[model samples]
Target: MNAQTVLASSGDEFKAPGPELFEFPPLFAGGPEWLTKPVVFAVFGSLVVVVFFWSAFANPKLVPRGVQNLGEVGYMFVRDQIGRPFLGKNTDQWMPLLMSVFFLIWIWNIFAVVPIIQFPIASHIAFPAVLAASVYFIKIYLGIKHQGPVKYFTNMIPSGLPLPVYFLLVPIEYLSTFILAPFTHAVRLFANMFAGHTILAFFSLVGFWFLFEKPTVAGFSVGIIGVLVTIVMTAFELLIQFLQAFLFTMLAAMYIQSGLHAEH
Candidate 1:
């Protein structure tokens, strides 16, 4: 049955947010396939990143002002927190890419709490998967280039182990590095976004359903609790979004650094 029939079937019923909450129908509905809310937001997020940096650094101020100052703060945060710790001396070269990744993921995530654009782009698995795959490919390429193909595999597996142990350890190490690394990288960001958005939706829907849709003296207290929970969760989700973005970028840097220097 349709949504109307479902709602109509129940009298004074409240519907909790579920997977259906995340399933946004096409924006165009009947028009182009590519035009959807998530796609638009993703593209908009990218443009915002580019334009923001461009505007920030467009005019070179000696001391810094306005957007330039904020831009510098973000740049230093990524460099000092993520790039330097992971890539060391090479941080300068990778700063642009790292900063872009950090901000893009962050903005995509922050959109979840933004009014009207109440969906986190990273909640979609594909978004994180593509980024993780890109980093994975780069990691493999760097490893092969720095250490020859033969040495790369050798270094990937631990040394000083008994020869017999290779049967068990080598496959584990191989699968962990070559396969599970990327899989986990993507899933970590996606899972956090998906779960965070779901929680926010749940509480928000609770407040709306209990207070606005079918309010009663008995349910008023419950609705207040829902509103309070939504507020609390939104604040918490903000922290998670920033941390997730940092983590994704940090892991990318870690993978690249690992590729540069083989483990003993």
Candidate 2:
């Protein structure tokens, strides 16, 4: 018989709700619960960063051994490959900033697939938005500090434009680079992760739905397909996680570069 017919025939005997997928009920409805999965994940991520850096920097070796080697590689990758290309001579001064951004983003992205903590913090708009705004403020501050207030504004507006075109171009440039850029940066990361997680959740739940909700020969057949799809999606999410982190960091560096060379 078809899965539906079997399910109908089984009725309440096989109608138990499936296990919870990805929800955490608030303790006491309104209580300020200190111990939650998200809190744990955040703390864990922080610890991972701290330990890794500590191990990498605690005992520096000339030849670079153990965690030191890993740390140096990561630092150099961001500093040399990313920061230096953009900031040039000023790259060293910005190493800390770039390193922090790179590691924090990488950890957050990786944690999305960390079994128990399947949710990505960056998927929440607030987190990425705050980070993007921080970079935005830094860019503006650096621009003013290096170029002065009068020149900073002037530098932002493109040169060699017709007098009449200045009116139209100025507003467009201001809004695009200064106002909209940061929002887009944050949204780009947030939306990608959010959509990725949502798709994962959907497929996962669908797999469970077929496996248990409609437990029959036909149901099992379709359910197995869902399982395969879920596996593929999980792998895709892993790639996306790394890509999003790298893109966010690279764009941040590019923004800093723009601010540094706005007068050029």
Candidate 3:
């Protein structure tokens, strides 16, 4: 699913939603080009995360209940599953960043299914790119700071590799670890959200147009099928949204831990 276009035709023929659906019109004529729905949703997504955790943990509680209980569960999931596996004893040092990213991303994706604000902030690419770039730079800076610049790259080479094999492995290692890693990291989440939203919009439109806009006996079954598919995809997308958030944060923790220690 792609989403970036204007209407191709005004004819009665159904026009499948594409990249165009992702594009938002300006709040006012001649407004700043960057001012769009995605940016607004991104900011809102951040606020939601901040407000939620504050409400959950601002005051001391002898026994957690309601939001605190939920927040504790989320915190443990991040610490045990995402942070501890990679950072081990160092997990606490990075919990703030990991929790922020995990919750922010999950909320941003959950927005896709949310009414009134039905857009995943990461679907726009710029948001994920910014987060991934931050992690990439942090990884590099920590690697050089902790291991020394020379040792940072040198440590990447496995000890058992033969002398002759070093030539091929060097470029491959640098390309994969340094360059492709961040690129894929951002794109993985963006692509999943983008595609998932497009799919949802397409089927929802099908159901709406067939059932409400222009109804017919033959079209009724098609509309029902469209509605069923949308329902099924909605459930599947929610699981994916959670998984993508976990995967993104887990990769982030892995990158940080690798930076602090040598690959060898």
Candidate 4:
């Protein structure tokens, strides 16, 4: 079913879905205003990640089968592709964190395409901002712990440069590493999911509005095109959802690696 059915159905005039689509009122009247759909789904997304892995790994198996097999494949992908390459010996140590981030994000994105509950949790900047901030702090903590406090901040500014260059380069590097890193990290995911969700709702709305809601001789052809585009865009969006999750997790691992090895 199309999510954007009628933006506003006054006199049969069509309206486009906007930022209002991302906002939700309380699920029930008199409920807490803050208890919105994305909040509930964010908690649900976390539980879904926890449950799937626990069910798969909580039991020992000589030969993997069912969700265990599926779980292992996902586990190994994060471990090998994401963790091992950058983290090296610290890979297994960080698997739990890396796996959680990857699967949780992938599932959150999946919610956008799900029936009825079609909101992407990460579409909201707050969601990704929190995750990115957690990583940012962890990166700072690990950097301080591994490389001494003085050394950690100092290492961020490279050596062997001309003294004059340090005045300009030092601030830029520090800002990029400390501030802009997390900002971009969160925005990248939020922007992609936000735009993708809006685009899907738009095409779906177009098809529904033209096809059944207000069918006409000329609009019939346009409706068909809208539907075909929706199908194609959906496929593209699914791939994007998975890729964004992987990229976010990969970058997290890279940040962790940088913390462990200041030279990074």
Q: Clashing residue pairs, candidate 1?
A: none
In the range 86-184, model 2's lDDT, one tens digit per residue, is: 788988888888888878877987877787677887876767888999999988888888888889888877688789998898899889887799989
If scored against the real structure, what TM-score would every candidate get? 0.93, 0.85, 0.93, 0.94
Q: Candidates ranked by TM-score, best first? A: 4, 1, 3, 2
lDDT of 3: 0.89
lDDT of residue 15 for candidate 4 = 74
lDDT of 1 by residue, 1-264 (tens): 433343454455556678886676778659776667888999999999999999999896999999999999999999999999999998998888899999999999999988899999999888899999999898999999999999998988877889999999988988998899999999999999999999988888877876888776666666788899999999999999999999999999999899898977
Q: Give the 10-residue window scoring lowest on summed lDDT in candidate 4.
A: 1-10
lDDT of each: 0.89, 0.79, 0.89, 0.90
Regions of candidate 3 where Cα sits further than 4 Å from its true position? 1-11
Please say which candidate is ahead in lDDT: 2 or 4. 4
Model with the higher TM-score, candidate 3 or 4: 4
Candidate 3 collision pairs: 2-18, 2-19, 3-18, 3-19, 3-20, 4-19, 4-20, 5-20
Q: Candidate 4 lDDT, tens digit per residue, 6-125?
A: 333223666778999898999899999889999999999999999999999999599999999999999989998999999999999999999999999999999998997898899999
Alpha-carbon runs more than 4 Å astray in model 1: 1-11, 32-34
C-alpha RMSD values across all candidates: 4.0, 3.9, 4.2, 3.8
Candidate 2: list runs displaced more than 4 Å.
1-40
